[model samples]
Target: MKDKFEEAKPILTTLMAAGHQAFFVGGAVRDYLLGRESGDVDIATSARPEQVQALFQKVIPVGIEHGTVMVRHCGESYEVTTFRVEGEYSDFRHPDHVSFTSSIEEDLSRRDFTINAIAMDVEGGIVDPYHGQQDLRQQVLNTVRDASQRFLEDPLRMMRAARFVSQLGFRLSPNTKEALTTSRELLKEIAVERIAVEMEKLIAGRYVQEGVELLVESGLVHELPIFRNRNNLVPVLESVTSRPLQDMASFLSLLVHYSTIDVKTFMTEWKLSKATKNKAHTLLDGLERLSCDPLPYVLYRVGEELLDSFRELMDSVGYDQLHPKTSVGKLFKELPIKSRADLAVDGKDIKELFPDEKPGPWIQNLLNDIEYHVLLGQLQNDRNTIREWVIEWNPHDPS
Candidate 1:
């Protein structure tokens, strides 16, 4: 993991050369110690935001007010935030204000968790003022300070705690777990979008079932709109917990199925896009119709993308265990027409054949009819076969 930081080490070296303290901080350090692949490296520096910007050639002040800047180094962009202690969190989301600090301990003290508060200097020196490495070794997540106070500063920390259970495959310390249960109400103060982000990560995690159990046990599930009024969420949570979902749509598909609400309505409440709602709808339809496999019609109707999701969803529900089939994917691969685009003769070809008739609803209906026959193998997809079949079926001379 230390070798992985070679790309961003120059940023640390640059800050150090300028006589400002800088170190690899947060998840990057935690993940490095755990021997996991870290996403992005965050550098905490004693240099103020403006001073940090001056040192970088291409600097974007993405979150200057919060002491963060996007520094582009060697064709890679890195997020660099100044070491600071946050003021009171009035909204239970963001810090009302931040006070910059030179002491690393002061800056790390304000962090959410012990594992996340650990920092690594470029010379391979670790600054663990919060004993984060010990927590990582124990495979437990604990707050930097009092659990209740840490969660009170930002209620989203509660959801993040659950997400960490799935991501790091770690359990919360007893004190942290109690604080999460007590601070569950603070989650309602958080916006749905923030919870949605953490929920998505939580559901997609390696230990997703455990994460969701934490969410449910901690009463955080009650804060979500989709699960607020619902009771007996454990069965639904247990169903999907056994297997990993491929994407947010698949996860939402499993969740929405156990509910009385429609997929569109529930997804809309979570602030999901129209596209995601539509995809989940497609997956639900496929799940009901799949007899542990797809037929030719199902292949043509469900298409390729939904078929993969349906298979994953089926696994989540343990569908294949009862009605196992051989070579289900082979059926889709062998389909003659996956979509209208695969047809040998399209609407343009139909228009040319029916030159005397103006384009109208007939064109679309005719295309659909042609595709059905092509997929069913009743008619060959060759241009001449389709043209003759079209003329014969319609029995109209469009001279």
Candidate 2:
């Protein structure tokens, strides 16, 4: 079969004709060599960013300062970056400066790992200056150059190396592993958002157990204030191998495993958005309740979004597959209260019966009672009967 390169050939030819050396580069080349479908096609060229912009009518200067541009062709956008050597990384993230160079070898040398450093020229063929092909064939993760220097230049690359191990099911070379363990402290200089994104990918990977084990072994897990109780994560990692996680929230719940302090502290320390924090809390709550007999009230309280998350959580922990007979599965099928909108009566209907009563706490209390009744399956969901019960309902009367 003709690979994804067929779709990108025309663009490569166009740039080549313009007196620029264009070739498919980065993860695309790695994936192609590994017999996997490439997710995105990245092109590297000898031409500067401005030259690329001039060649394409609809060029987007997405990272122009860094000699990168997005060229639109055939209704698709392809990232085209000029081969460049980076300067010292003062921030341990972005380089202090970047200089476009003509030598592709120089550009490849600056990359984080040998596997990711390989590039392929469309006509000239693969460029393996660092023997990345050998490393790939060996199924090992090795650094392109000095591991400490490379990781110190950008600490996130250390985590990324581990992530690639998890993602590609590869083993880290001894030297590479040592470098990661030594460089674990450098992660403190990286941003939370970058750390969170890598963590999510690492946990979601097929070999998450390996990646997480590496993190803990390298002492990177304890560096994060939220992961101080790293021991709790062992069971969580064991759980994730069974079921694929639906989203980050479910993954977070598994990582924390019902630890109230860890969850709250991690969320706050990571500066997670309020929406994400709430979702993570909901997943944890559901998982905690499901650890025992799955209860209808628990399902009603957790809602459908969380119920789905709970199923994923169970699967991640290597529990029995969530079949229809499972308590969670059954509760999912028979959620008596689908939504607040499913309540039998509304405020307006209650108002009509008790015209003298103002819409206040009592009205909300009656709705809550009706919702509880619907959830318990005690009463048929009818507006007339619900309204009658609301009229006579007295909070003060215990009987």
User: Highest TM-score among the candidates is held by which one?
Assistant: 1
Pairs of colliding residues, candidate 1: none
Could you tell me the lDDT of residue 104 within candidate 2? Answer: 89
lDDT per residue, candidate 1, 323-388, as tens digits? 688345887788887777788987888899878888887888888888878777888989999999
**How does residue 161 of candidate 2 score in lDDT?**
83
Clashes of each: 0, 4
How far out, in Å, is residue 266 in model 1?
Answer: 0.6
Q: What are the runs in model 2 whose C-alpha is more than 4 Å off? A: 1-4, 228-246, 255-257, 260-263, 291-301, 304-307, 316-324, 327-337, 354-358, 388-399
Clashing pairs for predicted structure model 2, backbone only: 239-316, 239-317, 240-316, 243-315
How many Å off is the CA of 292 in candidate 1?
10
TM-score on alpha carbons, each prediction: 0.90, 0.86
